[model samples]
Target: MTELLKPELYAVVGTMSAPLHPSLKGGRCMACGFVFFPPQRYGCEVCGRSGDCLQSIALSGSGTLIASATVHMHSPGARPTKHGVKPLEAPFTIGTIKLDDGPTIRTIIVDANEPSLKPGQRVISKLVEVGSGACSILDLRFAPAL
Candidate 1:
């Protein structure tokens, strides 16, 4: 009884897993051989191919920042901090990256705190913790290449 309860307790307090995977969500397209991230839902939206189409594929995570911009205002229903403190200056940078795997995606750049940016810079995706303890959300974010 105690062992069963311990497992349950651990689950309740454990960190949440991310939904996307580099291998499972960003690899070769089964139908067209095109690799992408946030993998295709049902069929190939680009080639219009169907049947035995789009499958979970791995992504290289390496990409070039094609374009970027900062968002100064928060959208409606945005989650506030656990301590009730809103971000002092919640500026976020969004960019479309051309991954080596052959697909482009709009992703948040975590290292966008800098005052400036340039196109064609290298970036990599990473999992980031967005909030406190149980209420946290794991999100994909990009950072400048090391």
Candidate 2:
């Protein structure tokens, strides 16, 4: 009937009207020229101006390990559960990666069972899935070069 069609049309429109996820696109400062991943707030902290810049910037995943340490305790953002991801194993290595773009991000180091790791080691970025279904979230992880 007409009533039934109306509801269906609204549903379709609602889905299309949903705001895109921030992680789906890279972000650029609208004030200065600083580009950041996962987007950034307007009004550049560097130039202190707004609406001067506007554009989407992609992040370069290439980077190097600046420091690393092993973690034995589960933290709020570290653990993954049935609904999400849990710590794969105890004493996992977490490292600070310095991107070529001058941004430093902290991430878990995958397959760090080697004898040891050192600073200045080449590393690559990878996406980690946490949770399941609609609640899933993507996390950043790094791995040492072979």
Instruction: Give TM-scores for every candidate, taking all chains together and pairing residue i with residue i.
Output: 0.66, 0.61
lDDT of 2 by residue, 1-146 (tens): 01111121111111122212111234566555665544554656566555537555444555688999887765557544344344466668888877655567776788675347789988765455543454545555667766
Name the candidate that leads on TM-score.
Answer: 1
**Runs of candidate 2 exceeding 4 Å displacement:** 1-26, 30-32, 52-54, 75-84, 87-89, 128-138
Supply the global lDDT for candidate 1.
0.58
| Candidate 2 clashing pairs, residues 3+ apart or interchain | 80-85, 80-86, 81-84, 81-85, 83-131, 84-131
| lDDT (Cα atoms) of all candidates against the true structure | 0.58, 0.55
Q: Which regions of candidate 1 are displaced past 4 Å?
A: 1-24, 80-89, 134-137
